[model samples]
Target: MQKREALEFDILFVGAGPANLASAIHLQRLLKRHNATAANPLEPSIAVIEKGRYAGAHLLSGALLDPRALDEFFPDYRAKGCPVEATVSKESIWFLQSKRKFAVPFIPEPFSNKNSLIVSLSRLGAWMAEQAENEGVQLFDNTAASAPFMENGKLTGIITDDKGIGKDGNSKTNFEPGLLLKAKAIVIGEGSDGSLTRQLSMHFPSISAAQRYETGVKETWEIPEERITAGEVHHTFGFPLESDVYGGGWLYAFSPTLVSVGCISSVGHDSPVCDPHLNLQRFKLHPLIANILKSGKMVESGARTITSGGLDAMPPLCGPGYLLTGESAGMVNMQRHKGIHLAMKSGTIAAETLFEALLHNDFSTGRLKSSEERFRNSWAWEELHAARNYRKAFDKGLYSGLVQAGLQLGIPGLSLKTTQLTLPGFTETPSFNPKKKKIALPVIPEFRADGMRTFSKERSLFSSGVMHEENQPCHLVIKREDIAEICLKKCKKEFANPCQHFCPAGVYEITTEPVPALKLNPSNCLHCKTCEIADPYGIITWTTPEGGGGPGYKLS
Candidate 1:
């Protein structure tokens, strides 16, 4: 490894997405206020690192519907150059059965607007990054942060793969070699279920792995002239065989020529059913969806891992010298399939909390925990809480059946009211149960030499005949006895089987076949690990390898 000079900063922000950018802006504003009033103006140096080549190039969204969080964070966002492609003119939910379609209107409380605006997240991210840079925040793209740097049980900075460096040592001094970033504090906005955040949570047992993830596979298409206009968004609950899965699909037409379509599934580590992409393809073939896309052409396709582990699944938001925000801390409203807004709100609150901590010269867990409280008090938390129980209802086959039923009645009011009324109560009592019967499988080492060697040499592996890339080598090893002990001691098979239905990659295979086995094709694995948490058996564990070994997407 090449040695290089270390850099110092007061705050090192990991990730350049909406969350990080929002925090950067808020921090600068707070500093300005502090400097204006205090005797000594504290100018805390801050830097933001983004793995993507550009700030928002990798940020994904399905035509963000009117984000109330945006209004709360930046009341003047529209006036301040936020781009709005088209205002949503029509919002309807559909329940489809083969060739028939049922449509109903949905109204989430307080968002009385039947028409919400559609936003281009790429443009939005760029704008936010620009604002951060103008406020003096250093931004570095294509810089991948792999782990948090720690000293005496406190976070200081991060270890990153310096992408700017060249082999011949002729690159810019700032990008010349491997270096440590020592900082007074670090804010992680590394997206839903980021590896470093997971590691940090592990270091602090108060945070549970259960508060983890969901997977989203989305594609953008160019709509034909005969189809719907820009400013229309559609959601569907009952597809051809709705009885089989717990997830649904969505279509958002941002422009007459552009539409975003996608699906989200619940998956666990031990599941052996459903591929997200395959589901999406099946969704497209649905009668209603087929007609919409009949004239449209596929433009972009990608996938995202989301944090849907809910309030109970949340990780510790703060620790000594470090703070976790956005998806890293499980701050997503899965019911709405929206996270960007929550991420931004959480980032803003985290920045404020940290700013206050700086004034007190305290960055300990006790002090940083204020961020978590702030988040809990915010509307984001309330919305997530409200939708929390709905996941079970969704799994109970309520979404597809009820949604379809409401549509058939042609009573949008009934459909909307039913969802609104039942959502909160359902969350109060999650009806989904796990399957109790246990199927014995032969004990196997968690880490197999054969699997490692195959993954290391080929860079691509197949399990159940699906191809996926293993960008990183495996670093976790477990004895077969350990697996047996975990199964015998800690396993509890639940009926909902979150992992089986949730994975976008369809990596887990859950069946009662003798020796319930999960065949991992690392290539198809998005590394979301919803399965790991769903595994009551504690059969799954994740480890880091040479950095930059996960999926590389053009627009994920």
Candidate 2:
């Protein structure tokens, strides 16, 4: 085992996203206020660790709408001069099916707006990071926090995966167990549930794994002169050919020649069965969408997970010496596809609560519980509550299907508001069964294609550039008959196969024949691991590939 020097700080924040950055800023301001009168004030020492090499590099490649809540966090955000493209000139929602469409004009409600500004998120994330640094927050990039450092039932800091040798041939560096950094408290803002957060949450039984999630696949396109333009954003329901699917698609214009389009779907739902990439391709081929992309060319495509667990799905916000914020605690509002704002607000609250607790030198759950109360009182909670209600109706397919049908009816005064009365409450009823049932698996055909000679053999297909290593062969002992039985059992228990719906690269196939069997198209696999999460059965296991193999993106 390798030993490394230990570092310490007053507070340690995980993740460098908007929420973490906002918290850093707010904490600085609070400390400054409290220490103004002290003869020898103790300044709060803070550190933020980011897995990515650059702040906001992961988010900047995409486009986002700037919410009004941004003003509450950064009053001079606009003046700071980030890469804001355009203020929304027009906003309209469409209930769409095939060639028919209905336009619904919704009035702005608190925390909800149709006319928000379009921004370059990559730039925005970097900007927030800079602001945090300017306020005396230390940042550690290219370093991942692997686990929380716990001592005597309190979170002190975190362990990191930071190991590299110097450029000189003789210089050598070895992997070291992360050093413990003692702090008064810690804040976990890790984006989504994974190995570390899962371990931490398990240690505290108050957190639940029932928090919901949805998969989002997005593609950016660069087209000709007449393709897409600024100020035009399109939302479509009842997508072409796949009218039975409950998910919706979007087309947002960034530059005159660049358009961002994608779809978001629930993880485990049947019907409207189609691959996300194929859906994007089909969406582009739609007469309405095609007309805009007539001369356009595909630029890039990516996928990410969205948390939809709502208020009921929230994890315990505070423990002995830690607070969970952002998506890590399930603060996303799926109804509006808004999470960034909520993440920022939650982080701010956590920081404020921590600052107060520090003043009294009380970091117990009693003092830190204020974070949860603040979250409930904020707009984030209200938005999540509404989204939870909307999802209840959405689950029955009544909300989206009826809205689409209503739009197609073309009644002059018809509007989504008119159907609001039909929306179901969160506690309405159980539309799905909790118990698993036995079902026959569909049979899939074998395609004997050379893996190396596959069409998608291009260098860009597999490398994420973030973490790329050579693939290694694995030798495992599992009976073939047992594997078959497990696969069949998984098909019955896990509703809505993830391989069929969420694969952005079209790697997995779900056959509708004799028995459902998953076919893997290794060549098209982007190594995104969505299939791994979507797999109710632990069938999809990943192994490191040959060095330097995988998709390499300009921006992810």
Candidate 3:
């Protein structure tokens, strides 16, 4: 069965990140301001596809940039060469403690950033894919998307992965076949947990709620220009996470010798060994982050998964023909740990609802669901419904989630009743029951990777330049083909396997001398779907891996 090759488009856009490159440069500036006063002149064709081998190769972030949706659709985005890197000036907040740190005097207007810029969201998505290819938009970088081309029951575009398969799965005389892109409108912005947005959420299901996630784990240091300063921002939250474990840690600078650090757990944190990269190596051995990385070096590393369920865990922002902007549509807010300007304001409101469905040709789901009622009437929906209970108010722990974030920042109408206090990041993990009493796990304080201040995970997957071809087809699947007796007798008797501590690029090993199985080092993937979102028993999935392969993040 090798006879594919179709390629139309009126609009395609599937993850070139930064919300489909700000909806393909704001739908090419709203079709050049409505074809400069239409006299029946509505041009359509626009594309954007990227499965990253470029366009910020699997982009990662700690990226602070709230440039208000890039000053509302590239208002000369710093004169169009926009890759800011430093502007913040100074901001602070802290609380850590495994050695001491307290700071937090003010700076909590949703963790203020002052001027906000410190970026590298993979170099601001390779400079927003060069302003979405200078606004004409058809960009394709290593392309991926592998499915959701549906026909009668809607969608209509995207099918791209196949290419030279082989590790015994055959078809390898440089086999190609995998292109049936067609499109009348497709948009997806695949990011958090997105494998074609989880196979189109089983035919557009998602009546909101039930989407929670958080995994972060970044790095990118250099430090030592007199110990940091360019835009110096910081943010911390209690010590190595166990007040029932939600998490946080950051550092931003990007200049006083290039900073940007990380940690951000809570993928439903109960514990299947809660390791967000060993809680980012116990948040860099916090003596206030080891004296700001004592001498600093680690140039880059990555991990991701954070569509932190705000606005009640979003999902169906238009169906039928499709449209779900950034972070595949949760459009993160998490009380302002921020989502690249709410994913570039949901890519400029999915480019103003696909420019009125391309001036009335109507790409259906009720005319693209009025781009979700114009994103719930903008201001990125009042900053994600005023931080809608910020990540489920830390699932009721960390000091009752900092007293429900200090009463939703001193009662901003109680964050509109917190979307009924949501849940679902795999119900915060721990459940194989064994008589219900398990959790006590938090002791994780060991450290000694020291290839110059903590390194291993195979040297942070070789500084996260993660490569893979090893004769194709093994995009980390394991949907329980008895994954070695389910990782040796029920994940080693209830969670001891924890995918070798939630895989921040070590790619799950478990090999007891070729007897206990589950080896899979899928080219040490850093495409961070965090073992398919903290795999409890639901076997791991994370597809799409042969499109210029994962991680080459140039500074995450």
Give each model's clash number.
Answer: 27, 19, 1
**Clashing residue pairs in candidate 3, if any?**
268-428
lDDT by residue for model 1 over 1-556, one digit each (tens)?
Answer: 4565679988889888788898988889889888998998888888998766567655666656446767766677788887777887877777777678887656554323354667766667888999899889999876667666777877887777643333343454544344577788888887765667756765676644455445566777776775887788787766633464556788877778778787765544443333555456666777767777775666556566666656556667787888877877777765566777778888899889979878888777788889878877888787767655444344446555455433433432223334422221112111223454554532212222222111111222121122222333332323457444433333323323334444445454445467654334444554445444444444455543333334433322
Best by lDDT: 3
- lDDT values, one for every candidate: 0.62, 0.60, 0.79
- Considering every candidate listed, which one attains the maximal TM-score? 2
Model 3 lDDT tens row, 126-206:
988987887778898888988887889888987899889887788899889789999988888877878887887777666
Candidates ranked by TM-score: 2, 1, 3
How well does candidate 2 match the true structure in TM-score terms? 0.77
lDDT of 2 by residue, 91-200 (tens): 55666666667775762342243566666555677888888898899987665665677778777777775343222312234533445556777888867554346557
- The lDDT of model 1 is 0.62
lDDT of 3 at 79: 77
Residue 460's lDDT in candidate 3: 80
Model 1 Cα displacement at 12 (Å)? 1.4
